[model samples]
Target: MELDVHKPTILVTGGAGYIGSNAAFLLSQQGYQVVIIDNFKHGQQFYPDWARVIKCDFSDQSILDQIFTHYNVEAVMHFAGLIEVGASVRDPKIFYEENVVKVLKLLNKMQEHGIDKFVFSSSAAVYGTPTKVPIVEEHPCNPINPYGNTKYAVECMLSDFSRAYGLNFVALRYFNAAGADVENGLGERHKPETHVIPLLLEAAQSGETFSIFGNDYQTPDGTCIRDYLHVKDLASAHYKALKFLDGNKSAVFNLGTGIGASVSELVNMVTKQTGLSINVEVKKRRSGDPDRLVADPSRASTLLGWKPEYSSLETIIADAWLFYQKPDAVLYYSDQSYQQSSVF
Candidate 1:
């Protein structure tokens, strides 16, 4: 999948994180030079051999100036932010600060550097308690939590910026990003893991009881339903969105499979994959837990020429089980200094 021999260099924020790292590696594989900037707040230490990994916060104007000046950065892929929904509910101020305020700073710097092309990492949480099963791009955004509100805020900001400042960007609202890039040894790694697939796999290995959150939802299994897409597919969508910006077009798309899986069903899949009995504990539903949230990803497919290849639930569980089984898998956190290039 070689692209232009001298494809434009892309600045990937939070590139050491799960999805961002996968996208950066793929971009470098496809011949697009990559420059990654991360604060390493919760990002992984698994730096790839391809990217010019810089350990700096994307919001730092001085460091961003160095990056934009040193490299011929043609676009920015913003992925750094506080993503924990539960935490966001507890403290909305930090979520707004990290996700919205810091991002605006980065966008301002990019605008100053004359870099108008952008790709945003959005969330499906924006469509709060969807009225329709397969949520579309045009669905009303009534986010029920602070995390979703932050993502929606950024989306609105991008829209206004595009209209006022000639900025071209794509906002990809992702559902549950699961699975692993097993080939690259890159999987989910959160400080306090909140995602379902990894948590279920962890419990399967450690024999810990996995909490089901709630089994009283209105779904088939009496549990909340969500659309899960492989992290690999999510990464590829970012690449496609970057290429879509080459036409100077701005659009919003949903990155998800038009399929929903319940918590009980996912637990069953994990058990099936590992051949281990998963101890499940039902708990009270968290605030604003949507009954069903799938995606009508037709807009992304039609516009970006992208579709999921590794998002099937069976494949997702298999790959994730393999990843968690490895004893020496990469973990997050490293003591790296600012402006350091981690190209190996």
Candidate 2:
């Protein structure tokens, strides 16, 4: 198979989804050719024009072989996987198949094609029920649920692959990924949206009562505290991880703001942003929820030179509100026009 060596190409596995789409756009802006493959199960039909979209599941080995045969894929940013913790708990089979088994197949194909660099979209869920606050990468990975187990399983697989096959990888274990690409008209649009930010926005806009599960946790406000990082910062970390892989090394980094915000604080932020008093109903805490899951992002900051630029509670809510208000806005790729102006 002939390869285009002039333009380095990145194959984004779930480039049509929320974080993946933004990563695709950022890669394109940084002058890398992007080829996106998504099943459209949880992703959207819209994407940047520069990216080549291939509608197929990552488990399809034949299709993957064809893609590797056609393009000179320099590296891969894998974001395609199931994320619902509750759903994973109910039916662990699908999570294993989609998240673990499919990813193994994709890695095998990458080995066949000699493409080694990988950036895995992992989760803070891997460090389930953290024994310490400001969780670090070395925290014991005792995932409390199947969704997190799948991610930890993949991280183990990546480690073995790197040791045996010389494949370099970076596993970014992210906390709550919130906010939207307001300039590009990209945001969270999950089928039954479960994220707190979007759910609160929906409740505020529609005057519906939103549920805050288990407010009597061991927190200052008796609510769960999570480290919310902006989607754009998460995307930038992917680009940085790709560059870091150029040194033929494997690493794990936590992606977050290192700041914890409780559920009550988030609700207050949304109310302030939208000027609508949101109604809330506190319920029993969901199973497998930790009281605090903030990140110690010093590793990512020191190594990748990446930090959360738009991760404040106020900015997160404001960006999400803009996207919620303009869901159908046209998305364009303009590097200079979309500069990070302070939203706070």
Q: State the lDDT of candidate 1 residue by residue for 77-153, as single tens digits.
A: 98889999989999999999999999899899999999999999999989988898799998999999999999999
lDDT of all the models against the reference?
0.87, 0.88
Per-prediction TM-score, please? 0.93, 0.94
lDDT per residue as tens, model 2, 188-240: 88876889899999999999999999988999999999999999999999999
How well does candidate 2 match the true structure in TM-score terms? 0.94
Task: Record all residue pairs in model 1 with backbone atoms less than 3 Å apart, i.e. clashing.
Answer: none
Scanning candidate 1 in windows of ten residues, the lowest lDDT window is 335-344
> Once superposed on the true structure, which residue ranges of model 2 sit more than 4 Å away at CA?
1-6, 328-344
